[model samples]
Target chain A: MTMRSLTGTGMTEDGMDELLAQFLVEAPELAQQLAEALLALERMPGPGQALDAAFRHAHTLKGSVQLFDLPPLAGLLHAAEDLLGALRAGDRAPDAAALDALMAAAGAVEGWIMGLARDGAGIGLPAEAAALGARHEAALRALLDGPAVPAAAEPAAALAWLPALLAEAADPLAEARSGSQPVTALHYRPAADCFFLGDDPFGLLRRLPGLIALRVTPRAAWDLESFDPFACNLDFAALSTAAPEALRQHMRFVADQVEWAGVAAAEPPASPTVAATRDPGQRLLRVEAARIDGMMDMVAELVVAKTGLAGLAREAGGPATPLGRSLAARGAEIDRLVAGLHRAVLGLRLVPLAQAFRRLPRLARELSAQLGKPVALQIEGEEVEADKSVVDALAEPLLHLLRNALDHGVEPPEARRAAGKSEAGRITLSARRQGDQIQVTLEDDGAGLDTAKLRRVAGERGLLPPAELDALDEAAAMALIFRAGFSTAAAVTGISGRGVGMDAVRAAIEALGGRVSVASRPGQGTSFRLTLPRATVITRVVLLRLGEARFGVPIEAVAETLRLPEAAITRLAEGEAFVLRGRALPLLRLSDLLGLPAAPAGTERRILVTAGPAPCGIAVDGFAERLDVMLRPMGGLLAGLPGALGTALLGDGVVLVVLDLDELAGGAAAPLPEAALS
Target chain B: MSIALEDGRLRLAGDCGVEEAETFLSMLQQHPGLAVDLAEVAALHTALLQVLLAFRPPLAAAPGEPGLARLLLPLLGR
Candidate 1:
């Protein structure tokens, strides 16, 4: 097998490089989140968790990229970090236009990361970085400058300090003494929310590099009137002769908040210094996954061999056979130990869900911006774990849902305000496990679907009859959004007016063995919920037999399996029907759907009544086997055949096609008639 | 410095690659080897695993960090 094929999915030869790539993947998302949060803060004028979340995510990306020495990305994040830091400190939050600039800068940095990943080395980005720096400085200048400074002068003033500072700051004397010096400084401060971020103030202070001298001064000796130990009010001063650039680099993320001064001397001032050090001799020893797989194969062989030996020993049973008994016991223990080790080895490949969730806020915000709507997004259950490839595949379609919500579900500011709602709409995005499946829900509280408009659109498109459109209630009308060419927007916008988006979303969700459903109200907003299995390695299916042919049904949709007595099923005009628990369900036989022969006479029929929220049932001849196996979807002509979701290989080597129960049972429109059933 | 073989021990000298595997294996085939040194190897990849698996040789590992050893353990199981 090719090395790429053997290592399983998403394992990179260089983990740090992969992590750097992931950082790029995550940064754009964080930038987008900050924009949305800024919008929310502007509209609601209250402190919400989204801003803090956006800040933390950006901080995390900044930290990860810093480890890789990606200076430009680090610099952009540093500016954003400063803005968020100031906002967190109770300064007036950034305005809309400033937030828009930051969002664009965020996009640029993300694009840079992607560029770096695609190419092994990053391009010389000095010009682009300087331009972004100028833009950020201009915004900061505008924020700090009052009406006294004309708005256009803010950019000129921000640029004014650069040349003089750059030229005068270059000191050759200091550079000569240090052998080649750039800059150096010492910064000291008590950490903000140190207790919450999980750090001990004194311990962190003690660990500072290049400690020329250190002293911690207690802010309050404890007045009985007010003394909060948890509220750390301590400050420290340190004199470090490390290069100011080194000091600044170390303190980059928190540079703005901390107080620091440049050290004029090249050497330390009579204090111990921990010089920065790294051993470049280190190398990553690579291993082939197939070798591990081969080892596992041998272990399996050993298990089988031991089993045979134990069986032989049992067959030759005798009380005096202590050696045989000992061998058997030892073999059993070895088998258990090997199995445990195998599971641990497999677990090393699992990655956290944060990698996926980290990108959503930015995407949500960007989509909202492009569609010209205000959306406040709240993401929960971000700590869920899954395989990395699955997470990568999830980004595009989830992003599409975000765009769909902003483009279609959310009403504009005037519409929301007129409906007695806050001008900024809310989108709550969450994921949690329901049974064996992960359920991701994207919900928006905007102007919900107008059933009348949906009816008119459906009638005009000739997708649904005017009578049928009239019959559809709010929930059913919203379902039309998933139909191909079913957009409700009056004019084509960049985001979703083409009408081809949601159909693709449906296909993508279903392709992953998941189902997507929409629920909406006229004035209350809309929600799209998707449920998918945790892993695609092995699929669990419910097997049904028709004549000699047996097919599999996904267990997710099988509500209940039953042995239907003849009296329970009642026939209706042009079709069969069954009344169960006060609801009339239309019955379609699996044999008829598959064009298979009928079952023999005098045999009791077994029917599996499958339905989702919309109840229906399918009658089949007999119950066969429910098996778990590796599933591969049939390609070419067989894939287009009605009702088959995918096919799996049964242990007996027979190929069983898995039926999509919802598509088959939800409607009475059978593609094949009894004449076609042979 | 690159990886080399000495006294039945695989001494990893200047980071050499799998193109040299045949010569190393032929030498090993003539004299069954055990110990291996990774001191000189700057990096290793899947090709080394393929070589080790091809020979099914038990490795008597020289000094290295646990991470290096852990990465090689599966292939060494052969």
Candidate 2:
């Protein structure tokens, strides 16, 4: 079918873009809701309110699609609406075939929506959608004619007879077993109100891949005298040789209603697994990230202006005067309001880690299948929220870590058995909030890091000197795995071993003001922990003075500040050093680092100790009050300057340059002053 | 509006909908064992289907339309 143009729909190009953007954002959520409601309806089979809700969703989606001049998608949704409308109006009883048709329509619409997202609205509908639309129309017609084929005829009565069904499936199950396919028994008890959501449980059953045998029975005895046909009272048990992921995908919409177990050659295990139900009405709003960032910039500026106002209020009469007191009171009020505004804006950028965590299970499943290692993924604290930018940046690093775990950390089934562990290895991804930071840890219960091998690899790759490698402790040796060009993998695989795995993960995390650490036990497991700031808008910094200029250093980077007399300073071959509590720290003057005029003879100097793998002490003229400030990264001409974290405006209208200590400590070859050498 | 009761039998015609379900169910409740004749039922609504399934009265005659017969005959255990 030929696609219609936006112009023909009487929408301006910009307006069309706006509408399409909104549609792209909203259509997927609506489709998901419809699918969930439909699955619920199938389980329960006839809730009037659910039917109405399903109908409304279909109708609204159709209207939206039609407004964009997409006839095929609109038509598909329209057919679904007709079916749902019929059920809602009580003009047609809920039936499997009808629901199947509606499901097909919904799927077709979903495809079109995805297509629109990938290729613009100008893209034409595929032929499959046209076929689906035809089927939907036929199903609606059949429903209008009368009940369609007795709704696939409920399975023969008596759960006890399931043994017979198993016998019938024996041949196919045997074939699956012989072919080395995993066979599983599935028990599905849809929500009782599934019909109201427009779900047909039998229809879903019919679509199960690699199906071998099936039995259907009511959870409770039906009372013919007072039977409510609309209420679903059915339970389905089936044997299938489909991959677990396929089964999971098929039942994702109604996950809470399914119990599945691996079927062995012997009697099938009777373990019952219940799916977790997510609250349906969790409120969410989608706003453009750029808009939020814009608002944040404004808030930062407002904070700076408020600080300037407070300074002015102080200068007006000093706190002792009545005028000064009133000004101070109002200034305090504005400060509180601005603080609240800053928090609210920052919260707008917070997103749950589940956004990235949801994709890992599928990845683990696929990788395990490919590598011939059965790995089960366990996720926890997925609901922990972090900055959206951080979450987006996290996906790649996490993927790399998981791939590394699957390829090298996890052992094959036979090997795991020999090791006295379950044949199925486990990889767990968990997140937790600690203070103002979110820590995400990925751990695998498999062959842990071989520290000896790591040390040898590090030495072989020249990552560490031979003597240093010999003196490395277990933790220090494990840290060698993150060094660039160091890999312990005996043979490189496409998944993870070009000698560039953990280092990249560390780099990505550290780029977000976070840190990565590794801990492993020889035969037990290995874990990578990433701790990142919850948000990056406002930062706490310890203000410092260098000559007449002021600077700021992040509090996280500052381990402690010490007042050192001139006598405590010691000279090293490369630079100045200071002894604090028996430990000598390499010290660099802030004035020398930034090329500012040296401080005049000082009464006393303060040293700000920085923390990291290698600690350093930065000597400054004096320490100023530590305060919270919105740090904005330098733009344009100063954007790429090394050692500059960002700049923040002080209360007295001075711009305090925040130093990136990591970069400054690591980068010292630019220029040297003769005074520092002496 | 598309249904009428005559001679102790419920005769249904045209399209029966949710609007008609309560009255039909009340009628069936009032007169148990009443037979149903659907010679003219062009369409059946879910509410009416509920009434029929719950009441399960004997059908005076099978639905005239083959499509309709295919739907209702097995359901009625004919």
Query: Could you give candidate 1's per-residue lDDT for residues B18-38 as a string of tens digits?
Result: 445455555555666556556
Work out the iRMS of candidate 2: 6.3
- Chain A only TM-scores, each candidate in turn: 0.50, 0.60
Of all true interface contacts, what fraction is found in model 1? 0.00
B-chain TM-score, candidate 2: 0.92
Please give, for residues A1-678, the per-residue lDDT of candidate 2 as tens digits.
333463245777778778877887778756755654564465446634346557878888877777766566676677678778777665577777666666656666666677766675566566576666676666655666555333333333323434434544544554565455778777788777776776666656656887766666556765656756566676777888888899999988888888876665432111011011122335655667899988976787787677665667778886888888888899889989988998898788888776666446556756887899998776656557888877877888898889999998999999899999999998878777788899999999989999888988888888867987999899989998777677677788877875567877876676666789999987899999999888876778888887777789889989899998877787667777776676666788877877777777576678888877667788888888777788765556775566777777665667788888877776552223434434
Candidate 1 lDDT, A230-289, residue by residue in tens = 444544454444665666676565565456554333321110110111111246333444
Window of ten residues with lowest summed lDDT in model 2 chain A: A268-277
- Model 1, runs deviating above 4 Å: A1-103, A118-352, A386-390, A471-473, A540-626, A631-678, B1-78
**How much lDDT does each candidate structure score?**
0.57, 0.72
lDDT of 2 at A80: 78
Error of 2 at B47 (Å): 32
| RMSD of each candidate relative to the true structure | 20.0, 18.1
